[model samples]
Target: MQLTDDRLIRADTDTVWRAILDPEVLKACIPGCENLTGSPEAGYEAVVAQKIGPVSARFAGVVSLSDLRPGEGLTLSGEGKGGAAGFAKGSAQVSFAAEGDATRLTYTVDANVGGKIAQLGSRLIDSFAKKLADQFFERFQAAVEGPGEAAEEELAEVDGDATAEKKGWFKRLVGG
Candidate 1:
């Protein structure tokens, strides 16, 4: 599946970039994510748990960042397996720009899945993906801007892919 989105962040691009690259910030924003270890140059390992449809499982995976342009953007890719549930792998290109005093973050994700997850229809998967993205971005924005600063107004242009892929993996682990 493919997904894209952009959101206006209240912080400056530099601040947003630094926050986005912070493992602690990411772990907090990702739903069901238990831990995230490593660095931008070395790569990261993650563990997450959730129930997708009727299946529940924990996924352990590795993510790498490449083609980095510093505070501008980079490519993020990773894959994970969930025993009998299934497996998922995908990548995303994320970029940032100055939007007045705020930052405009945009992302595009291209991903594929196999195992029982492939059996689920695209519509179901798409809706689930959207929900996951919305939740993650909402939380992420709040974290970056500070709690209570994440009013509905700032979420106006939000969009993109990584969170949905995480959601897909959760679904994949459960079954299609």
Candidate 2:
């Protein structure tokens, strides 16, 4: 399957680029993400719970960023396994253009699936992938431009606030 789209974010290219690479920002934006970890040299590892029509599964994957040109473009590639559900692998070339204080991000993705997911029909898979990508970009735009520079500082300050909050609640229940 193939998917493509572009969005304009009301932020500088540098800011947009930083948010795109920030693990916390991505985790907050990605739908059903259970975990996301980034490596300076090795890209990122993600665990995502996805539901397509009547099927639901957890997918673990590694996404690598390559051919990077700061504030310009890069290629994102990843493969995920969903056990009995299926497997998916794809690559997307993402390009950014400066538009005054805003940035325009354009992306084109080519993906392939095998197993149960492959058998589910192309229309379903295409629609699902489009929806997922749309949701990701929407959340990402909100995170980057919502609260101005203060939000950016806050994002940096509390990298794993979500996980920490969960841990805190668990500790309270255990009377730690």
Candidate 3:
């Protein structure tokens, strides 16, 4: 299956790029994502729990970013195995650009599934994937912008007051 979409985030291009590359931000945004380890430069490992149709499983995967241009674009490829539930593998091409004070992020993704997930049929898988993508972007936007501009200030303060604590907790949880 393939999917494409774009989002207009209310933040500068640099801020949006940095946040998207941050594992902590992705962990918080992606539904059922248990953790994300590693970095953009070294590839990333992800553990995600998901339920599709009647099957539920935990997927462990590795993702790598290629064709990278800092604060610009990258192509991400990954594959995940979910024991008896089957497997999924996909790649996404993401591009970023500035739009006034905000950022425009455009993405194109191609993926395939096998086992029980594929057994559920194409329509279901397509809808589920679309829903998950929507949820991810929504949460990502919130994480980057916060609750209006006030929340951004609060985050900056938090980053200052508990810099080590915050980073440590995130690193510990993600095992990075």
Candidate 4:
């Protein structure tokens, strides 16, 4: 499957870039994500429980980011095994541009699935993928917006903490 889209984030490009790289934010945004570990340098490992049509499975995989251009863009790629449910692999090229106080994020993805997942109707898989992507971006946008003032203040307090720990995948996805 192929997917392409863009979103406007109500935050500076640098802030949005940080949020995207934060594992905690990713974990929070990914649908049904159970765990996410590792750093950007080593790639992230994750276990996610997902249901597509009549198939429900726990997928374990490694997600990596490369071709980074600082606060501009990067490439994301990953492959996961869903046991009997199937397997999936995909890659996306992402770009970011400054737009006033907001940041514009654009992405183009190419994905493939095999085993039972491939046997399932394409419509089902397409819809599911679209839904998951939409959820991820929506959550990301909210996170970049800083949500409430208290949250923004907290982020500010830790802005230069340098000692901050790597967040979980959930945090990275949901921007928590």
Candidate 5:
């Protein structure tokens, strides 16, 4: 599968670049990521768990960044063997540019899978891949922008503070 998308991060180019290269930041951004260790120059090792359709796997892989251009961008490549579940490998070309006080990040990804997972057909696999990509990017954006940005935006669109709209835990549980 192939996918391309872009997001406007409400942070400076340099800050965004730093977050992209940070192992802790990357680990927090990737969904189901249990562990991520290593440096950009030497490549990183990762353990991620996920369930796609019916197949569940804990993938151990090596992720690497190449063609880096400081605060600009780089290519991210990785491959994971999921034992009998199958294997997945992919590469993403990522670019960054400053737009005013923010950074615009664009990524183009090409991914492939083989073995038992391939039997699931293209439609299911494609949708799962798209969801996974969206999840990673969304989480990354949130990490860079800091927590509560989305909640603040939502509150701004409403008439009152979001706290006033909240219900107690018991009320929500009983559909009160």
Candidate 6:
């Protein structure tokens, strides 16, 4: 599947660049991302749990950045195996630009799947992929700017240090 989209982030281009490079921000923004480790230079290892249709699986993958252009753009690519659920690999070419006082972030994605996931049909997979991409961008915007009403309610319902950790992560990025 191929998808292209963009959103205006309530942050400067530099700030958006920094947030894209931050592992914490990436971890928080990715839907169902249970754990993400490593740095931008060395690539990242991620574990994500997701339920698509009736298939639920835990995916382990490595994501890396390439084609660096400083504040302009870069490409993100990753592949994961979900045991019986099959495997997926994709790449996104992301671009960032300064628009007014905010940043306009755009991405074009190309993805492929095999194994049991391929049997799920292109319609289901395409819709799911679009939804996932939409969720990622929305959550990334919230992470860089501030939590929306739904995020606030979700944060309120979640107990303990998760919320605190998320807040601190954002603060650490913004504070410096």
- Who wins the lDDT comparison? 6
lDDT per residue as tens, model 4, 1-176: 78999997766788778877888777887778899999988899999888888899899998898998889999878789999989978777889999997789998877777899888888888878777777777777765663445555566577865344443333354554
Candidate 6's TM-score: 0.85
lDDT measured at residue 133 in model 1 versus the true structure, 0 to 100: 62
Candidate 6 positional error at 99, Å: 0.8
Alpha carbon deviation, residue 63, candidate 2 (Å)? 1.3
lDDT of 2 by residue, 58-133 (tens): 9999878889888898887778899999987888888999998789999898878788888889999988888877
Candidate that beats the other on lDDT, 1 or 5, i.e. the better one:
5
Off by over 4 Å in 3: 148-176
**On a 0 to 100 scale, what is the lDDT of residue 112 in model 1?**
67
Q: Which candidate, 1 or 5, would have the higher TM-score against the true structure? A: 5
Per-residue lDDT tens digits for candidate 5, residues 18-76, read 87887877788777889999999999999989887899998899999999999999998
Cα RMSD, each candidate: 11.1, 9.3, 6.3, 7.3, 8.1, 4.9
lDDT of each: 0.71, 0.77, 0.79, 0.80, 0.82, 0.84
Error of 6 at 120 (Å): 0.5
lDDT of 6 at 54: 88
Pick by TM-score: 2 or 3, better one: 3
Q: What shift in Å separates residue 102 of candidate 1 from its native position after superposition?
A: 0.3
lDDT of 4 at 58: 92
- For candidate 4, what is the lDDT? 0.80
Q: What lDDT tens digits, residue by residue, belong to model 3 across residues 18-131?
A: 776787887887778898899888988999899998889999999777898888988878789999999988777888999998889898888788998899999998888777
TM-score for each of the candidates: 0.79, 0.79, 0.80, 0.81, 0.85, 0.85
Off by over 4 Å in 1: 148-176
Better of 1 and 2 by TM-score: 2
